[model samples]
Target: MTGGSGGHGGGRGGAVAAVDLGATSGRVMIGRLTDGIVSLEAVARFPNGPVPHADGLHWDFRALFEHIVTGLAEAVAREPQLASIGIDSWAVDYGLLRDGELLAEPFHYRDDRTEAGVDLVHALEPFDELYRRNGLQFLPFNTLYQFAVDAPVAEADTALLIPDLVAYLLTGARVAERTNASTTGLVDVAHASWDTALAERIGIPPTLLPDLVSPGTHLGRLTPELTARVGAPLDVVTVGSHDTASAVVAVPMADPATSAYISCGTWGLVGVELEQPLVTDAAREANFTNEGGVDGRVRFLHNVTGLWLLSETLRAWEDEDGAAIDLPALLDAAAGVDGPVPLFDANDPSLSAPGDMPARIAAVLRSAGAQAPVGRPAFVRAIIESIAQAFADAVHTAARLTGRRLETVHIVGGGSLNRPLCQATADRTGLPVLAGPVEATALGNVLVQGRALGWFGDDATLETLRATVAASVTPVGYEPRNGGTSL
Candidate 1:
């Protein structure tokens, strides 16, 4: 489920592997569940990211596919009796096929070509109407705009989302997995399928889109040729192909009344899962999304700019300096720094693209009439503070929009490891922050596979898995030392 760096989850020893491909890295994790605990072991891990091109950013699909095969081979070597394989990746970006061959390199969602297409499409269908039909947020990089800009979609024989494409490569089976496809603006929320009318409206050939398949269905076995080459079983099962969906599946749903999750990594998706999608006008107005989850649930959430902002800033700093700073030590130092001045909105589009974040953040702070940090610790403080404030805003908005008073906010993913950010979120949101299962996406991916493969029967099985591996970190409640505010 980790579409960022890690591939995670399969129960302790029933025999399954998840090929989790993310923006930064890819991994093949072998999972097995025994005595109600899911244990994952990494069989192979590799570095991955977008390749910058003259047109924009492009994914090296061939390289990624090769890495996936290698991982699967490693998994089989580690556990020769693998039951089935599942693949999940970051959502929205896709590949097109003509004559059953990939037409060109898959475009990265971060491509600038989608800049004006959202407004252009809304001019045709109106924003609210689109939202009502799709239940998706208005990110410019959404698949709709990307497809809209690349009109004449009819030329391609098929369109495949990232993970689906990976599954297709393994099994020679084609499907548009519902969980990930839902992230595309082209999917109809109410129908849970690709909107043919919307495709026509966007000038894409309806045939380009594949048949919609729900999660937990087996796509097919890995192709015989691939199996022979890799020396492993080629069978692949489609779990929640989308990383977020798989991550939400792993969220330990302890109490429906109190638990919420922040799937924090590339994008800090913060929300609660519901039995059904909340399609109210308030949800639409608040720009919240109701994405599909495993087993017919909805992930009511908001996609906030996450550690991308912090990591990019750090990368920029490292690029300028010859050496890399110690991240954990720097964060500890930042936690001790004072006078952060004011935090800027992390959603600023300026920070959305690849850039010199340290300079850009400083410029924004200066323009806002706030003092910018000079030292590394102070800079780190600003980034963490900004993330905490954003988390606070998102949690508050999610509560108001969904009409649920979130009792506890669960911070999962890598960001949850940031003690300062977790404490700040707890302080700012005035809620108990339970942090852990840093590999929630992988855990979720593994649990879904466990359920689908009959390793466990029901939700209780998942709870047991969580109880065995998930660790809890209580927030160090921040009080108003100066009596101004608690956050």
Candidate 2:
């Protein structure tokens, strides 16, 4: 066992562990399902972020695997009667395997390699045509463009996205989990299957993609090697492998038509879930995405730059011995400050890369003809306000473009832990807010795993589980006194 810890049965009596990897951190949660309620306990957690390197930002795959093994050991010690395991991670970035070995360290999606590939990709398949066919956004780091940036496709035997790579390591199985695969901009929107023709056109061999699997397909058991090494029973099952898809699966919407969602975290994905891809020019012009979701749903959302702005700002402040600045107190201070600068463009590419965020915000404001904040609290407030304003605009555009009257916005994920952000979002959007079920990604992972094992009846849809675990938070109204802020 990686951690060499011990225990009896823990998760739901029907124990299933989930390995949920996010960009900033990773955790192994042991879930317990008894009767109809699900309970979760964290067996282990560790920092899991990008490693800066000369070639580009690379993932610490070895370290992540070590941590996973250690966490599994702990989970087994605590809940010896484990049923199955599933993994979900951020989308697009992948691992290359050749001759049964990982070819090289997986490149982080934020790497500059993709910077030069967008025009080339557009040249091969015009953006509008590609959008009509695939229904994905024009992110620079999508797997299609990322692969286009590489020298040649013949260099690798297989390309496995993050969650698939992790599953392969766990169960010696290799298949593209459908939900995450759709985010690569290479999947057929209608079928949620890999697009071989597109792959050929982009110069990547079709064989590089493994057979695709739906969310709950059983891959296999944990290898005998892992069983002996860890001395515990292990099982591997597929969940919504894309973290956002999993989160959406657990969105807690009472009715799909009336609900909009903000999978608030490192990135704030704001939009509604639809039965089909809304591939209209207006949807395209609004830059909204029709990302694939569980049960043949389309997650029509925009990938808004989220708390990264605030988190980065806080990091810079911490560097200046500003650790004692409590967030609640900071928000109070920000509320006291008057006349926030007009909404600034939150999606500026300059804000996309990592650096001094406070300085970046200052620069963005100056360029936009808005004055920089007088102090740190003011700056933080400006960022929060601007993000909310942006959300407001997106929600309106989403409604107009999709013809769906979204009655509420459900904010889930790590960023939902920020109360002021939620309140500001609610105020800015002028819609009721429901926050929490903070473990949205993990819960979604577990629900799919649960369904796979037949723990619940066939009628145990994701919406049912979401409704069971969801908690709601209402808006703390904020009305613009002078004038409504605008970007």
Q: Give the candidate number with the greatest TM-score.
A: 2
lDDT of 2 by residue, 180-204 (tens): 8999889988878888998899788
State TM-scores per candidate: 0.92, 0.92
Per-residue lDDT value at 258 in model 1? 57
Winning candidate number (lDDT): 2
lDDT of each: 0.78, 0.80
Itemize residue pairs with steric clashes in candidate 2.
6-77, 7-77, 11-31, 11-32, 12-32, 12-33
Off by over 4 Å in 1: 1-13, 458-487
Weakest ten-residue segment in model 1 by summed lDDT: 1-10
lDDT of 1 by residue, 1-487 (tens): 1111112223434768888888788889987776656677888888877789887898999998998888888888878878778888999999988777887789888878888777678777887888988998778898888888764355788889999998888877888888999998888888788888987876777888888887767666778888886777645677888888887766665765557788888789988878777887888877899888776678888889999888888888888897897999998999899754479988888888888988888888888898787788888888888888888888888877777767777787777788888887877787777776677777777766666665554343435545545433222233322332211
